[model samples]
Target: MTDALNDDRKGWMSLLAKAPPARLAALMPDLPDHALLRAPEVGAVMVRGRTGATGAPFNLGEMTVTRCSVRLAEGAVGHAWVQGRDKAHALRAAVVDALMQTPESAGLHACVLAPLAAEAELARAVRAGKAAATKVDFFTMVRGEDA
Candidate 1:
């Protein structure tokens, strides 16, 4: 796949992962039946962290996650991994991923991804606002002699 396509898929997958399950479910219309290549299963993955964005990574902890993979009748395959053990969420995400690769992806992007992106952006703005409200800037006033 082209880098741009991969990036686009990554963006949507991240959005799907972070989206609220109920909200995502509400946005989904009737889905076509597909075979589950990998049924939704709960597992723990070791979380890792870095002191800074470029720092050496270390194990942060383990987090419970659920993953699912599905293949559509038209041969599109999708996969999803979501935090927590929501099987339905995983299934839905996987299906969406697969569908997004098809020619009819435009509708999926409109009906699903667009709203999720909006919601995610709104949440980010709210969070940034809250953080900014508490931000403290430190400055040292120069004495007359120093100035």
Candidate 2:
């Protein structure tokens, strides 16, 4: 794939993975002609984390994930792995992924990804506001002897 296509795919995948199931359902477009290359399946994967963002990676724990794969009639294949056991969400995401690789991608990006990205940004802002409300500041007092 070209760099531009890869970048677009990455952006859409991030939005899809973070989007709530209800939100995705509300914006779902008409399904394209496709075949389920791999039916949605729920499984566990080892969640890994890196220390201080640059240290050695370590297994955080096992997380439940649902994954699905689909192949469009035009031969584009798409895959999705989402957190939780929502098979429907995984299937929809995979279908969208496949569609994004086709000529209809521009429409999908505008109708689906744009809205989802906006919603995700709004949700993040709300969370940040809540966190900021409770933020505490620390200071040190100088002793008289220090004069």
lDDT of every model, 2 decimals = 0.93, 0.89
| lDDT tens readout by residue for model 2, 1-147 | 899968878888878877898889889945777799999999999989999979999999999999999999899998899999999899889999998888889988899999899888999999999999999897768868896
- Evaluated against the true structure, the overall lDDT of model 1 is 0.93
- Each candidate's number of clashing pairs is 0, 0
Tell me which residue pairs clash in candidate 2. Answer: none
Best by TM-score: 1
Error of 1 at 101 (Å): 0.9
Q: Give per-residue CA lDDT, model 1, range 6-99, as digits (tens).
A: 9999999988988899999999956788999999999999999997867999999999999999999999999999999899999999999999
